[model samples]
Target: MIMFEDLFQSTTSVSLLVVLVLLVLQFFYSSFSSKQQREPPGPKPFPLLGNLFQLDLKRLDICLLNLSKTHGSVFTIYLGPKKVVVLAGYKTVKQALVSHAEEFGERDITPLFHDINKGNGILFTNGDRWKEMRRFALSTLRDFGMGKSLTEERIIEECHHLIKSFEQNEGKAFNNSQTLTYAASNIISGIMFGRRFEYTDPVFQAMVERDRELIHLMGSASAQIYNMLPWLGPFIKNWKTMMKNIKENNEELKCIIADLKESLNPEMCRCFIDAFLMHKLKLEESEIKDSQYHEENLVNSVMNLFAAGTDTTANTLQWSLLYMAKYPHVQDQVQEELIRVIGSRQVRVEDRKYLPYTDAAIHEAQRFANIVPVISSHRMSQDVIFQGYFIKKGTSVFVLLSSVLYDESEWESPHTFNPSHFLDKEGRFIRRDAFLPFSAGRRVCLGESLARMELFLFFTSLLQRFRFTAPPGVTEDELDLTPVPGLIFSPPPHELCAVSRH
Candidate 1:
């Protein structure tokens, strides 16, 4: 009887020890899982629809900005099944893009981006291919006088053509969108093909028009829907149109590349294409395996450069003119600065420093226009604990550039077209850290220097010669400040009177 009792006691002891060990493991597991699921706070998502009903995709920038107010800086929103984490305000955006750049560096190749380039271009691709292509493009652009005097001279010459085009308007109300796009596209064309197209060239006009259409279509409501639910691609009208534009543009680029190849000179690198071809030949001679310098990369890179180099710069210039027409007093001040500082001599790139208010006005236009509201979405490369929130690898991140540009903490008058935002009390042009229109870190716009130079030279020169005003029948108040929703916020289709200051 004693022996039986001892065996029962031993069994009881073993059972209790097993229970205690299980409790310890449960405690650790529960703690770790809680940490893992601690994602950024967001509105409760529906089972399948997600936060779709809650958003205004038309003005996505404004919609997301409003959501940030309720959800705080880092938050989540789902479009259908895709969960996107947005970083808002200047502080949060700067920190994520600049401080933890590598962590949030990879391009999130959405269904649309993948369809467009097939993971081939500098803009949408990642890994070793992206790095090599970007480095090559930057170096080749520098060789072709991207930010140097050679480019300035090219812009100056182009400025003359632009001025003559404006002269054709004869101070009457006219839509200058096509002309401006042509001029901007010509600058990039010169670098890409070693020649510029006349504004009247059918090929040039078609190319620019198609690109503008593609950009607009990419931001359409239908396109957004297609992005979320890609199986709807065949049914989506915008998607069909975009694919057609892409195919046509791709063919045109291939033909241009073929012509350039016909007149091959290994020693004389005429332009970007020549430089690329020469590099490829050298690699082949050296028997380098799997070089990234191939025809597909060349075609896609040129297309990327051509579209980006043209649209944003042209759209910003368009906005500047519209703003001048809308606010005559600001226009007067800019003109006064130009007259005082330049006195009708060709406004050189060197003249930027001497004209502070003019420079501030230009800067303000960019900030206020907010051309690219949200940057192309970035993909998180690794699991990161950011701002005390756990973000998993491969999550799509949208850096709301609109939030940063219009952050109340960063700008004294965040909602207004105030050049004083970029000016100090002494009336000097002061650089604002929050001015991030070109974006920051790895995927920042590669053509920033060239774009800046273009803006300064084109703007000052045009303002020096022309006084933009509302159309004769339209009052300044009638001129709408509402932007046409697109991949870029472009000034709505409106006519402006370019009264000659000469």
Candidate 2:
């Protein structure tokens, strides 16, 4: 009787356990289904092609912004099979990148960048490696006076070189792109290698030229196609050219690293490379394995800094000049401020506060240029329910910076180039929350401080010495403001005569 009773109880318990397990499975399935239902809404994506037919790949930022009008601030869009969630406008972008920062902070390394970077470098990396490298770089930059007087002096010196290059035009029509890039490149070079190359150096010119081409090619339609379908790489002409440029640039960087390694002294670190070498040596001596201070990280970080440090700042400065030429009245206001405040003296970083109009003009140029329309996409670090939408972990997110910069709600004149956007009624320079040309959050431009100093010193000094105007036959209206679309929105190829003010 006892055995039979026990057997009955065991059978009952087994049945109950099975029933409980089924209930648990059903609960989870229902939860997951609900979450999927809550996923951000989007235009119906066709199989295989996704939403490719709906998007303008060339002007993706504008297209996404337009889509946001109907789809709401945060919406889903597909590129081929890949799904991207775009965060549009100032409020949405700021919320995603700043409020829920950790959730939306990872860099979404597209197939193309992944192939090139191989999960290395500060630009397109995440986790501890990225954290370590970024922390080190920021510390090193501060040590070298990134925002301090040391950097100010470096930028002021480069201003002289850039001025000399402009003066070579003799008030004649000439492309200022190369010289601007060279000047910008030299600042990063000084930080990296502790030396600047002459603008005329063939090797230096080649490196800068190659870097510029790389930036342009990276934004080409072929590059976009390659990212969506990497198997088509060989057939894509731009892809082929980009790869060649990368290979060449990598080789050049390796050689520079090697030379720096030979003369690295622990007691006296000269620049970024030397500092990195010293850190690596310390790690090795302490028997630390798997250090993030490896050569790949160093080289890739240098490349990231070099490319980013050069391209965007140069492009903005270029656009500033173009805007000055286009609106002579605005230029006159800026130059007038410079003369009244700084009068035949070197334009120093300290002078910005005194020259509010000039300061506003510079800020306006950055806002108007919208140089990096959409920054490198940020990947969701974990599953997040953001603003009532379920975003799965690892989902790629595009913060449409163009939308933020040109948001109708954010700016008084969203479509016009008005310096007063950054100025108050009292004619004092006012900081606008929408001014995010360097982006924000964890992955904000690492060289922002340096870039700021460079812009103020370079722009002010140049304005102090010369007046930028359209070329001989070109009218201000005729000088094109159409941006050459790329990873950057560079002013279209045009000439401006830097007529000497003196």
- TM-score of every model versus the real structure: 0.93, 0.92
**Model 2, residue 500: what's the lDDT?**
92
lDDT tens per residue, model 1, 250-275: 99999999999999887788889999
lDDT of 1 at 148: 91
Our tally of clashes for model 1 stands at 0
Model 2 Cα lDDT, one tens digit per residue, 1-502: 0123443467666875675566456545533564655877788776546688998888887788789999999888878667788888999888888899899889988888886677888988899999999999899888887998888888888998999989988888888988999999999899998999999999899988888998898887778888875655766778777788778888999999999898877788899999999999999999999899999999899988899899888998999998999999999998888888778978877777888898899999999999989875689999998999988898888889999999999999989999999888999889999888888888888889989888888888888888898988778889888788898989999888999988
**What total of clashing residue pairs does each candidate reach?**
0, 0
State candidate 2's TM-score: 0.92
| Alpha carbon deviation, residue 275, candidate 1 (Å) | 0.7
Poorly placed runs, candidate 2 (over 4 Å): 1-35
How does model 1 score by TM-score?
A: 0.93
